[model samples]
Target chain A: MNREIQLIKRPEAAPSHEHLKVVETEQPEPRQGEALVKLLYVSVDPYMRGRMSDAESYIAPFQLNEPMEGGVVAEVVQSKDDSLNQGDIVTAMLPWREYALVKADSVRKVDPSLGPVTTSLGILGMPGLTAYFGLMDIGQPQKGETLVVSGAAGAVGSTVVQIGKIVGCHVVGIAGSDEKTSYLMNELGVDEVINYKKENMADALANACPDGVDVYFDNVGGDISDRVYPLLNKYARIAQCGAIASYNVPNDQGPRMQMHLIKSSALIKGFTVGDYQTRFNEGFNYLSKWLKEGKLTYEETVQEGFETIPDAFFGLFEGKNIGKQLVKVSEPSSN
Target chain B: MNREIQLIKRPEAAPSHEHLKVVETEQPEPRQGEALVKLLYVSVDPYMRGRMSDAESYIAPFQLNEPMEGGVVAEVVQSKDDSLNQGDIVTAMLPWREYALVKADSVRKVDPSLGPVTTSLGILGMPGLTAYFGLMDIGQPQKGETLVVSGAAGAVGSTVVQIGKIVGCHVVGIAGSDEKTSYLMNELGVDEVINYKKENMADALANACPDGVDVYFDNVGGDISDRVYPLLNKYARIAQCGAIASYNVPNDQGPRMQMHLIKSSALIKGFTVGDYQTRFNEGFNYLSKWLKEGKLTYEETVQEGFETIPDAFFGLFEGKNIGKQLVKVSEPSSN
Candidate 1:
């Protein structure tokens, strides 16, 4: 029997452990063209909070009595298809469970030699792809242009700062703590880091970007985004990734953005990483090359044990993790 | 001597007659390379309200104790330049005064053979250029796409509906009254009309467009825009021309927009007609062809006399005009 966390009830405020129930479930067998993957790591993201509610959204809501779905890195224990085999590591959309039986085509075999299989859930995977495409396609940061990114020490934000630097842009990052700010500047090669908790955001941003912000990759919206609004240059592009500030708020009270948009003639666009799945291979190839060249680096805060999955997911809202927050359910098996 | 209304005090709310004071000034002779033009008509637009306040905006605020400036059709009373002769009809940015001493190069000779010089301020001038470039460049409406335009009987909105019809798109106009709605369907060839005052906006929009809206040309951005927000298709574009609904409101009470942008992967862009000065001639030539072919029609609610300029400006906020609102300041003098 395996312990699985199921959504017992929809959440009104910040989703607590009470909203989820840990119950024992019988392990199932893999069907035809399916693989039984022993879950190793499950990712915690801000977008998952939107799915928890019964409100109308881009994606379907998480059902009341079902396990919540998210990105996970797993090891194949058994396979019914010829393409995948036992002991092959892969990434798939599995729930908060110790094991999952997913369709073979739905899972992609992860190349461990490229980097850690855990990085597949962070820098070399969805978060990495989001940063690459969002910045290049939406933000369109040109050479010598100032690129400002909020939530800059997290998985997606860190990747954006690195990619901006690689493209010859002046990258400025906004992080929560001094440690995260130090990590961003020292390891990520970010041009400047603003400790949003300690420093005055408007002053720091204005000082860091003397010319003007040309591309704003927004992850944590609210007052942080409000401060960055007026500093935007004409024809600036804004990539709206996430609104971590308003995720926990029950009512609809985000930032006042109409006046800002009209004032700057800026382009603010919201997009999901799944929308660019057709360009996944291209993103992976470029990201892999950068990782191999030591131009890209990723970090993860892994909470051990399958029972800790709920705590790991809850930790995201509290800003407990430095980079990508993941729950490691099982250990890798030696071939 | 000519009487001109000069800015007396910066307005806080709806501009009254007290904010402007008529002062009699000496009518000077035409200088070298300049022409003295007797004003005929003056354009009154929502954007002028922004200029009335002593606040920083895209365009410079109207200087206190100085004559206001806007698009005007006039005739040259005297000329010192070879390019312009006496009694030649011209169009220039020199309205709100009886007589204007303008540089010869700054004014364009209006051809009365095409249409009335007043049409230049409505269909063939700023409003026309605003609709042309905003629809083609920003909205990018394709055939069979459903376009929803607010303030349907107003200057820019009316032009947008006609242009959408020219591009073979299903155009839906939302206006304040039944008369304006009738004008849009009967004269402008809009496929559907929704009188926001009489009908429920959401239900009316759902009934008018079954497939959902692709392009939302927003001229009045309050409740009308909020109603169209949910019905937008994926990757829909919103040409945010003016916010006539919130123009009179204080700065602290703007419309909410952050959640709307995130839910629909919509693009809301703000633009000024002056930004497209380089492409002005191109837009003028195309709109002129459309006008000559009878594919487009325009209505002007002309308020007679220069003294009625304040009344005409205030009439815009009340939605009193049918199409473009113009104040006739003087009579046209034939050479």
Candidate 2:
């Protein structure tokens, strides 16, 4: 028997055990051009919360009572396709199951020679690409200009602050805890770090961004964003990447921002990494080059066991993860 | 004696009579390069509200006890310069005085052959240029797309809707009254009109735009904008031209829009006409050609006397004007 986690019910607010259920199922078999793989690491992201609801969005909603799917790193146990050999480690968007069958074309072989295979789900994958294009393309940071990143310790934002620094900007990071703030300051070399949980946001932001904010990489949109808007300099740019603050909270309300936008003549563009599909090679080349030169780094908060997937996902809204949050299901069968 | 209006006080909420005061002063002589001009038509605009306050804005605040100034059509009563002759009608940014000395180069000659001298204060001047750049550059209305214009019966918006129609779009106009709606539909040839005061905006918008909103030229930002945000199609663009609804209302609050933007991958750009000053000639050429070809038209809601300028400015918040609101102080001394 194989274990699988299914979406039992759609969430109206914060997701919990009541919305998801773990069940037993028979082992899946591989057909032509398919490979049977065992889950090694499962990626849990904030955007998946949008798919949990039945609302119309950029991506499709998860089917009720069906296995919830997401980015995963797995090891192939049996292969019918010539492209995938036994014990080959691959990453693909797969369902939450201990054992599953995926078409050979759907999964890409992980090049471990570059770095660890897990980097494909974090720094070297979607989150890194999101940070790259969203910051370089939308934010358009310039030397000596101020760049503010909300959720600075999260998967996408952590990379954004580093890129902002590499581009010679006055980088300011806003995070929830002292540990996160310390990491952003000491490790990431951020110009300033505001512990939002302990500091007054408006006063702290004003103190941090005395020259005024020029580029804002917004991941957590709420009162934090409200404070950042009034500080935007003339011709500022905002890369609206994620809004994890509103994902779990129903009917979130705040001060209207249209006037602020008008006063500053700012521009805000909302996008996902998938929107840059054709330019993946361009982004990958830049990111990998930076990583290889020791100019870029990443971190992961991993929970050990498939049963903790729901808890890991739920912790995202609570600001519990330090970086990329993942569930380590099992070690590779052969390495 | 010459009459001038001064900002005596600033209001925390709605602007009223108490904020302005009328004073009498002596008319002065013109210097060597100066011409003494009498005010004929004074333009009253919504953006003036931002200047009424002492807040740091794109333009300077209205100094207390000093005369308020804006775009005006004036007649040269006496000329000490070679550029002007007696009775020449010109347009310039002038103070609220019946007769004042202006440097010859400060004002431009208004060619009456274009339409009328008053057109300089309406369709042929600032309002017309605002409508042209805000819609064409920011909104980017493509053929066969859905273009929605808020404040559709007002000066900038009225022109925006006509341009949308000219671009072969399914144009939807939102206004406050049946009179305004009928004017937008019949006179401007808008494909659909919504009297936001009478109909439920969300339902009406849904019925009017079956395909979804591709471009939104927002002039009145408040509840109307909230309804339009959720219906934005993929890669939509919004020109944040004005927020008349929130200018007087302090501490305005509404539903957050970050999620809607991310879902649609939309872009919102806020700008003023001054931002496009270098390209004014391009905008002017298009507008003049369109007017000459009868593809564009304009309306003016002119109040009598200079004393009514404050009231005309105040009336904008109440949606009392159908199109360009101006105070006709005096007719042209000649012609």
Candidate 3:
């Protein structure tokens, strides 16, 4: 028997049990050039929030009454293709089910020796590459420049903060809670962390970046992004990665930035990891090297069991995740 | 004898007669490494409006109770350096005075055989360089791509519109009046012209750019820029040259553009011509060649008399000029 979670309805704000339903289904069988896999971990990310709605976006919305799909780590239990073995661990964009019968082309083999298999869904995955290209290719933070990262404690933001520091920039992070701020400062070695929830955000950001912002990695947009507007230096670069705060409705925006952009002679570029799919190997290789050298660290708020996947996804908006948020469906077959 | 205009006070909105004063002064003598020049032509630019105010910008604000200085074509009457001689035509950042005593290093000799000595203040000067680099280096208009230019009849904007047409782009122009629109469509060969003052800007823009805007040369950056924001295509480029629309009082701006940028994966680069000062020789050479071949044509709204310089400057804010607005201080001594 296989248990699967489906999107029963679209959520207006915070997703609840009404929007998602878990169902027991028959175990799926594989055909030629296909494999049957048992999911070991399920990843929940903020971009999934964009896919849950019927709103126009880069990617299509998840269909209601169908199984929802996301980044997943699973072990191949039955194989029809000679390339994949029964005990092989793989990563795939598969449905939130205990077992998945998918074509061999859908799954990618993740090396088990690279920290953990779940790292394939976090540091070595989309979030890591998003930070790498968005910051390096676009932001191009120079030495002694002020680099500010909003959503500083999340998977992508934490990685960006470290990269900014390594490149000799002064890194300031903006996060929702004091705990998240502490994580960024203590573990990530961020120069300054603003607890946007408690502090006067604009003042804190201004005080932190007195020389003005040279590069901004915008993750959580709205007030945080608005506050950074007045502080941009000449030729400043903004890498717009995500707008988690406004992902729900997306209507409320602050004052027009063209005047400020004119005054500073700044640049803003929006991108997705899919934009750099050809360069995935470069980012992933460097990321694995950094993880081994202890230059980067990551945390995951892991929920237990397959049924708790929806709860874990909703917890992302509540800021419950420390870095990456994932659900532990089951232990590795070998372990 | 010398008569010059001085800035008495910074203007709140549109400049008035009270903001500037005319003062008659004695002839200035040149010291060692200096030359005495008799002013012939002076340039009145929109950027000077920012200099009149104390607001912090890329360049220093013009000081009050002093003769306002800008791009001028003058004849050297007295020279203390060996390279300079009597009756030499030169371009310099000289005061508004009828005769200016300036350092020999402060001025460069102009080749009148290139086009016109006044062309050094119009098509071959800062406005020309502004259009050249802003459109080529940043906007990068591709062949068969849709390009929209605001303030399309002004100096820099007109040059950009012509360049867009020359580069095999489907060029659409936006201007404030019917006459300006006619000039763009009929003479400049702009594919479409939207009279912004008469039509619904958003609808007209949408109708003009059926394939969506690939490159936008933004010269008037308030509501005009806002209307074009919605019609941006994926990977659009915005070359922000000026904000003439909000030059007087910058408080009234529309909503922020982060969401729209994210949707289209666009890039907006705000730049001043000063940023490309190093590449001036290359652009000037090409511009001179273009003028000789009659590939580019220019119109100058010449304001006669040195005493009427302030009126020509005010004419910029009121949109009275068709192209480059210039003040004729005097006739060139020999040429």
Candidate 4:
């Protein structure tokens, strides 16, 4: 027997348990060119919220009454393809079933020698790649320039702020809680940290960035972004990675930014990790090298059990996770 | 005796006669390394509106009670330097006086052979360069891609739309009136025209761009731009050249665009012509060659008299100009 999480209904605003349902299902069997993967670690991210709504987006909307799918670390219990073997620890975009059948080609074996297999779903995977490209490519942080990261305590943003530091930029991180700010300051060696919940963003940003912001890695776009826009230096670059703030708020309206962009001659580029698919290996190489040299680090907030997957995902919107939020579904078993 | 227009007061809303005043002044003699020039054609543009308010911007704000200055075609009345001679038709950023002394190097000689001397203020000048770089560098319109231009009949936008045609794009022009639409469609050879004042923008844009918008050259940034955001194709590019719609309206609020940008993975770049100062000759060669070959044409709304400059400048916000709006100050004297 196996259990699966399905989208019972599409969310109009913020996602909740009402939109999803946990159901029992028969165990999936591997067919030719496929492998039976038992879920080990389930990754939950803010971007997943966009897939719940049936809007014309970069990716397709999650189908109602079907198991929701996302990045996961799993173990192969049965194999029907030469590429994958039983007991292999792999990672792939898999459906939310406790045990599911996937094409062998879809799942890549995690090299545990580098770190934990869970890193494949995190620092060595989507979030890390997102941070790498969005910062280096779009943000283009130059040495001694001011770099600001919103949602700085989260998965992608935490990685972005660290990269900003590596580039010798005066890095400022904006997070929701004092604990997150402390982690960004003490653990990550960020130049400045602003607890958005405690301080006036405009004043804090002004005090933090004495020289106006040169590079901005925006993850939470709403009032947080609105404050940053006015402080942009001439020829500034903004990597508009994620707008998790507006995902649950429909028809989110704010002060127009066209004037601000023109005043500073700034550029804003919105992108997803998928946009850089061709350069994934290049990103992976740099991330792995940095990890090996101890120049990069990561954090994970793990929630236990398959039943907690929905709650773990819901926690993203509330900023409950300090870093990469994952659910430990089951331990990998030996062949 | 000479006359000059000065910004007496800054407008909180729309600019009008109350904010500007005509003042009498004494004509000055030219010093060594300077030339005395008589204004011929005063170029009135939308960007000038930005200088009226004391805001931190790319260019310095217009000082209160000082003569407002901008691009102008002038006739050198007397020369105290070798670089410029008497009666030479030149163009430069000069004060709004009937006659004024300027540094010889500050004014560039306008070759009369490159169409009319007024072309220095229109198709062969700042507007042309703005259209060139904003479209070519930022918009990156590929052949067969759908390109949309808002405020399509204005100086910068008119040139941009024509350039889109030259680049073999399916160009859609959005303007305020039927006459402007006709100028864009019948005269400029734009594939589609939308009179934003007359039609439902979302529906009109949907009907015009069936393949979706690949490039958006936005000049008017308000509700018109909000409509274009949803229809952007994958990896769309936007040249945010101007926001005339919001220049007069303080704290202009609109639907947040971060989600729209993320949905399509688009890029928006805001710029002024000065940002491409180094490539001026490159832009000029392309524009002049296109003009000589009849590949590009332009329109000018010329208002007579020195006093009419204020009204001409004011008219920009009303969408009164068909193309480049200029105030003819005086005819040039033969050497």
Candidate 5:
């Protein structure tokens, strides 16, 4: 029996496990050019929260009574395609389920020797690509410039800090807690860390970055972003990666940043990894090399069961995730 | 006796004539490398409204009990400088006074034979440069792309529409009234016009731009900007030039647009002409050629008398100006 978490209804606030129900169904058959993937791990991100609500968003909302979908690292249980074979490790977008049958071409083979398959769902996957393109293309951080990132302890934000450091920028991170702040400053080599919870964010930011910020990589938008707005130098670049702060809120009380933007003569752009499909291979190769050299390190807050997916997702909203949040569904298969 | 309007106190709302007092000052002498200019036309823009408040902004706030200063087209009555001669037409940053003395280098000579001296303050001056750079550099309208401009009958907005048309884009305009709408569509050759006062902006935008908006030249940034946000196509660009709608309001409340931006993969950039000073000569030469060739037309709502400077400045907030608003302090010099 294959157990799948079906979305029973749309959510109003932080979605709970009650909003989802585990249902059992007969295993699906793989037709020609298709393969069956037994899920190992599933990635949970703040953007997924947007998909749960039935609203106009970047990606379509998860339909009611349908299994929620996202990036998954799986192993092929059965194959009917020429390219893929049974027992081949692969990555696909088949989420919140124990097993899924999808088009073989839709799945990419993952080399187990490269790193952990779960890393493909984190550092080598969508979040990594998001950080790569957003920083390089949108933020356009120059060497010796000050790069400030909000939500700096999370997956995308942490990645941005490391990348900014690698590119020779003076990186300042703003995270929710002191532990995350220390990790960013000590482990990630970020020049400074502002504990937004305990400190005056604006004053700390101004003090840390005496020369105004050159690149602002935003993940949690609100007062933190509002505080960063006025300190941006002329021609400063802002990459609007995510608004984790406002994602769960039902009303429109986000920060008013228009005046600050105008006064600074800055550029604020919204970007997604999907937009850089043509350059994905380049980014992946670069990040993979950086990972192997130990120049990059990623942290994961792994939840133990498929049942904990909703809880793990909600953890993101409460700033519970230390880094990348993932749900381990099954043990890895040794081929 | 020389009369000038002096800033009496910082204002909280629409600056009434009482905020300014017409006072007599001694006729000033021209220092070395200076020229005495009899003021002809003084320019009034929305940005000046921001200057009236003693708050942190892009430029310094107007000083209390000081003469109000802005772009003025004048005639040099005396010269103590090598660069300028007596009886030369020039444009300078001068007070709202009948006469003034300024360094010769502080003023640029305007050839009335090229176009009207008033044109120096209108199409061939700051407004022209604003439209040129804001549209071309930031908005980047492509041929056949739909360019929608708010405040389309006003100075900067009208120039944006005309320049959009020149760049081979289909231009749609939004104005405050039917007469302004007609002027944009009929006289300015804007492809379509919406009277924002009567029409449902979203419905009108949908009807006018069936293919979706490719570029938005936003001047009035409140409900009109909010209405245009949903109409933007993939990779749309917004040049946030002004927010006249919220300039006078004690508090501004608008819909949060961060999510909408991510959905469209759009860019919103706020800029000033000063930011593009490196390219000013390029923009000036291009606009000057266009103005002389009859490719561009600019209108002015001239409020006669120096005391009307306050009223002329306030007119921008009420959407009363047809084009660039100017204060006529004295008659034009024929010599």
Candidate 6:
């Protein structure tokens, strides 16, 4: 038997165990030009909340009943194609299944030497590339300028905070809890950390960035951004990456910011990693080099067993995990 | 005797004749490096409203009891500098006085061949440079892209519409009055016109740009802009130039737009003409070439006589002017 999680119904507010149904199905076989992949680690991200709904977005909505797809790190158990061999580590948009029979061309080979195969999902994958293009390309933080990162403990925000420090900027991280704030401040060496829930977020952000914010890496958009807008200096730049706050809202109506952008002569640009697909190699080289040089460090919260997949996903909205949230189903037999 | 309009006190809301004091004083003689200029056409712009109150901004607040400064097309009556000559036409930041004693370096000599010398205050001046840089540098409207301009009858917005057309973009102009809408449609050949006051602006805007608004040249930042934000497509660009609506408001609190920018991957950038000082010559040359080719046309609502200066300036906030609002204090004898 094979195990997988399926979206039995759409989430009303925050996703819970009720919204997902874990099922056991027959193990799938690899056809010609395909590989039978056994899941080792799979990612549960904030962006997945958007895909679970039927909202019109950059990507298509996740369909009901079958299986929800996401970035997965798996091992080849069997191969019918020359490109992939048994025991090879790979990354693909594989469904939430213990085993996935996918076309060889659908997945990319991963080298374990580049940290761990798990880093491919956290620091060197979608979240990493999101932080890279959004911060470097759009935010364009200058030395001595102040940079503010929302969702500072999450995968993308943590990467953005480190990059800001690397560029010699005053980095302020906005997180929800004390532990997350301490992790950002003590471990990551972030210049300041504002636990948004503990204090008046607007006043705390202003206290943190006394010189005013020049660049903002916006991973979580809500009241945190509302507070950030009024503190923007002239010619300030905002990289709008994710809006996990309003993803669950039936209608994504939040706040309006035309006057703020106009008055400060500021700039807010939204972008996805897909926009920088052609420049992935450049981003990967820079990120990997920094990781090896000890200039960047990352943390992940992992849950073991295939049965705990839905709870691992629900943990994302509850802020139950720090850094990247992943579920460990199995370890590759050889590697 | 020299006549000039002095700001007596800051107005609470819209400026009226009561806020201004017309005075007759002795004209000062020009010193070395100074020229005694006779004012021909003095402009009363929306930006001046911001300078009236003690608000911290890009430019300092106007000092009370001093004749308010503005764009002036004037004649050099007497010169102590070799660069300027008697009867030479020049453009400078001159007070609302009949005679202005200013440093010769403070003024740029105007060529009469560039349409009209008064064009120095309208199309060939700060407003024109504003439209040029905001549209080209920030908006970056490509060929076949749809562009929407707010305050379409105003100096900066009118110029933006024509340039959008010249760049092969489908141009849409939004104005308060039907007359202004007709002017944009018939006279300027704008592809679409939205009478913001008379129609459902959002639905009209949606109907106007069926493909979706790509570049928005926003001059009036209020309800019109509030409506435009929802209609942005993927990679939309908003050029924030002026906020006429919020200039008088004590505290500038309007909409919040992070979610929209994130969803559409759009861009909103605010700018001033001063930001493009290095690129003025480039903007000027292009504007002049286009103007001479019969591609751009401009209108001015002029009030003659020095005594009418207060009323002329007040007309700007009332939406009484269709295009550039100018106070014609005197006519240049040569031109």
Best by the lDDT measure: 4
State which candidate, 3 or 6, has the greater DockQ: 3
TM-score per model (chain B) = 0.96, 0.98, 0.97, 0.99, 0.97, 0.97
TM-score of chain B taken alone, candidate 4: 0.99
**lDDT of each residue in A28-114, candidate 1, tens digit only:** 888888888888888988889888988776789998888988899888899998888999999988888787887778888898899
Q: List the residue pairs that clash in candidate 3.
A: none
Model 5 ranges off by over 4 Å: none
Candidate 1: stretches off by over 4 Å = B254-256
Q: Considering DockQ, where higher is better, how would the candidates rank from best to worst?
A: 2, 4, 5, 3, 1, 6
Residue B328, candidate 4: C-alpha displacement in angstroms: 0.8
The true-versus-predicted C-alpha distance at residue A277 of model 1, in Å, is 2.0
Could you give candidate 1's per-residue lDDT for residues B1-335 as a string of tens digits?
89888888877777788888888888878888988889988998888887888664677889889988889888888888889988898888874789889887798888987898888898998999999988888899999999999988999889999999999999999998888999999888899999999999889999999999899888887778878887878788988788777666665443345555666677888778877889999999999999999999999898898788888888888889999999888777762
Residue A210 in candidate 5, Cα distance off native in Å: 2.3
Q: Where in model 6 is the C-alpha error above 4 Å?
A: A8-13, A16-18, A23-26, A201-203, A249-256, B1-3, B8-26, B249-255, B333-335
RMSD of 2: 1.1
- Candidates 1 and 5: which is better by TM-score? 5
The two-chain DockQ for each candidate, comma-separated, is 0.48, 0.89, 0.49, 0.88, 0.64, 0.43
lDDT of 3 by residue, B123-184 (tens): 89999999999999999999999999998899999988888887899999998888898988
Candidate no. 4 TM-score: 0.99
Instruction: Give lDDT for model 1.
Output: 0.85
lDDT per residue for candidate 4 within B1-335, as digits (tens), equals 99999999999889999999999999898888988899999999899999999998999999999999999999988889888888888899999999999887688999988899988888999999999999999999899999999989999999999999999999999999999999999999999999998999889999999999999999989999999999999899999999988999989999999988888889999999999999999999999999999999999999999999999998999999999999999877873
Worst 10 residues of 5 chain A by lDDT: A251-260
- Per-residue lDDT over A1-335 for candidate 2, one digit per residue giving the tens place of the 0 to 100 score: 89999999999899999999999999988998889999999999999999999999999999999989999999999999999998999999999999999888899899998798888998899999999999999999999999999999999999999999999999999999999999999889999999999999999999999999999999989999999999999999999999988998888999999988999999999999999999999998898899999999989999999988999988998999987999999999875
lDDT of 5 by residue, A1-335 (tens): 88888899777877787678788877888888888888888888888888888876667889889888888888888888888877788888875789888786788889877798888888888888899999999998999999999999998888999999999999999999988999899899999999999999878998999999999999988778878887988788999888877786676664456766787888888877899999999999988999999989999989888877878877888898877999988876763
